[model samples]
Target: MPNNMTAVFLPGNKQVDVRAVLVPEPGPDEVLVEIKASCICRSDLSLYYGNAVISGGDSNQFVCGHEPAGTVVKVGEAVTEFAEGDNVAVYLAVGCGVCHHCRVGIHYLCAKWKCLGFTMDGGNAEFLRVPARNLLKTPKGMSHLAAAISTDAFGTLFSACRKVGVNGLSTIGIWGLGPMGAAGTLAAKAMGGRVVALDPIAERREFAESLGADLVLDPTAPNALDQVREFSGGEGLSGAIDCSGQTAAHNMALDAAAPMARIALVGENRETTIKTSDHMIRKQLTVFGSWYFSIDEYADILALIKSHKIDLERLATHTFDLKEAETAFRMFDNRETEKAVFVR
Candidate 1:
């Protein structure tokens, strides 16, 4: 193993810094992974813009690339479940193991939650040290790029779709056609839901269509909701997901959903307003926010991936070497790519 490695850091003002840093050593309950693929996420943009959504630490000081997958190269003495040569992808949330949330494998909800790439040294580098419990075993033949994206982009949506009970009979509306929305489309379709996707951008709408969306519409159009109703045969959508994190999209999702339908808010919007009795009480709609998945749910997620033969690499519109961190971040920030990854 090399004594040093290259890692990327975002120091605000849309700046990216690639630096040579010492390779990290794993602690007693951790394993050191030789990173093969790391994906850039939309959430990382906040740190790039000099303001981070999650506070309590200097995000710039940590290596930044959370959605990562690779091979375990070294293990700490206390690490028993994983060893050298095992292929794995990391779950980003690190929490106090004894907490109620962590006990249930919903570590992100723990009071002492610390996230990879935000509060800790993450996988932007060639190597990353993470707790053994956070390591997800990758199935055979799963490409490194696919493994990386499956950890966050695909996995998050998978959990959300599961929560909303998407199935063969569902006609779901998805707002926003970014990687998250794309994942929602894939997950919804895999479970037999007819997806009606919406996006203002022509290319994103087209991308959603190419991903097997039953219908794609421009949300800004004069009668976008009308199109949704028409597509749903006047019954209205059975479920909806808003990945845009925009207030307008949230409102549209509620406005277009059928009575008794469920809505999962998977986006990272700071605030939004909704008509209480009109959108929820009257319609008897169920709405809830979903973040990452439980560790135990990975088995179901992997089974779905295998049975559906999901091609995660299709979402990766661009790939770059670690040295191209600047260009990669800039292009991703500018919305020029559908999905981008850093590969060894």
Candidate 2:
């Protein structure tokens, strides 16, 4: 094992750098992963711009890649379940083991929740030391890139759609055809839902179509909402997922939903206006703010991916070597790529 390794760091103000650092040693209940791939998420923008959405956005103190997958290279004495050389994807949210949320496997909701790349060092490096319990064993044939992305992109969308009761008979509207929106499109289609994907960008709309979205529309169009209504046969959407944090997209999703429809807001947004009566009360609609999935759900999620033959690897429009962190992040931030990943 190397005594030192190179890792990425964001010094705020859109600065990105790679630095030489010591390879982390596994602590009690921890395992050191030789990262094969780490994905750059849209949320990483907060860290890049110097105003992170997470409470403790200490850019200088932590490596900044949360969606990571790699092979285990070292394990602490207490880590018995996961042996060295096991391929695994990391679950970013760490919690106090005794908390009710952690007990229920929803680590992200724990009162003392601390996320990788936010509160702790993450996988934008050659190696990462994570708690063994956070390890999700990858299927035998899963690619490192797919495992990395599945950790959040596909996994979160799958959880969101499942929560909304998406099924073969459902017509689901997905707002914001970014990586998350594209992921929502894939998940909905795999689950047999008729998908209506909306985005202002022609490229994103086309990407969604390629992912099997039944309908793709420009949300900025004057008759977009009307189009959604008409597309759903004037019955309104059976379910809707807003993957864009934009207020307009949120409004469109709520307004286009049918009575008794289920809506899941998967996008991270600070604020958005809502028409309480007309969008919710009058329609008897159910709206949920869905975040990351419970740790236990990974099994079912992977199973669904296997059963549906989802090509998660195809979602990555670009992949960069670790040295190209700047270029990778720059292009991703500029919306030049659908999904981008860092490879060792």
Candidate 3:
């Protein structure tokens, strides 16, 4: 193993730093992962502009990628279930093990949690050191790139689709065609829901159509909601997922939802206005927010991927070596690519 490795950092203000740093060593319960693939997420842009959304936005000094997959090269003395040579995807949160949230496998909700790539060093490097509890085993045949994307891109939406109860009878309208939205489209379809994917960007809409969405439309079109209704046979959407985080998309989802519809808000947005009486109370809607999948859900998630023959790698339109971090971030920020990744 190399004594030193190249790591990427987002020093705020659209800066990308590829620095040489010592490879981290595993602690008593930690594992050292030789990162093979690390994905760039839209949330990373918050750090790019110096206003981080996670870890309280107080720091951007650590390595900067949360979705990473690789082979475990070293395990601490306390590690048992996972050993060197195991393939795994890292869970971003590190919580005190004894906490109720950690016990329930929702580490991100732990009060004193440390987020990888936000508060601590992350996997945008040749190696990553993390607590063994945060390791998610990757099954055989799942490529490093797919495993990486599976963490955030697909896993999140998969969880969201489950939350909204996507099924054969579902007429789900997905707002946004970014990686998350695109992943949601696939998840809904795989779950047997007919999907209507909406995004203003023509390329993104086209990509969603290629992903097997029943229909795709420009969200900005004057008759966009009409198109969604038509796709749903004028019954309105049985379920709706908002991955755009835009106020317009949020309201649109509510407006297009059928009576007794289920809605999953998967995107991160500061604020959005909703009509209470009309969009909620009278309609008896079911709405909830889904962040990431529970650690235990990975088994079913992997099964769904394999059973449905989902090619998660198709979501990554661009890949780069760590040295090309700047170009990768630039193109991603400009929406020039979907699911750009950093490869070792």
Q: How accurate is candidate 3 locally (lDDT)?
A: 0.91
Q: Report the error of model 1 at residue 164, Å.
A: 1.1
lDDT of 2 by residue, 65-158 (tens): 8999999999999888999889999999999978899999999999998898878898899999998999999999999999998989999999
Worst 10 contiguous positions by lDDT, candidate 1: 50-59
Candidate 2 residues lying further than 4 Å off, grouped into runs, are none
C-alpha RMSD values across all candidates: 0.9, 1.0, 1.1
- Clash pairs, candidate 3, are none
Error of 1 at 299 (Å): 0.9
How would you order the candidates by lDDT, starting with the best?
A: 1, 2, 3
| Predicted model with the maximum lDDT | 1
Clashes of each: 0, 0, 0
lDDT of each: 0.92, 0.91, 0.91
* TM-score, cand. 2: 0.98
Candidate 3, residue 26: lDDT: 95
Query: What's the TM-score of every candidate structure?
Result: 0.98, 0.98, 0.98
- Which digits, one per residue and each the tens of the lDDT, describe model 1 over residues 94-162? 999998999999998899988889888889889999999899999889988999989889999999999
TM for candidate 1 is: 0.98
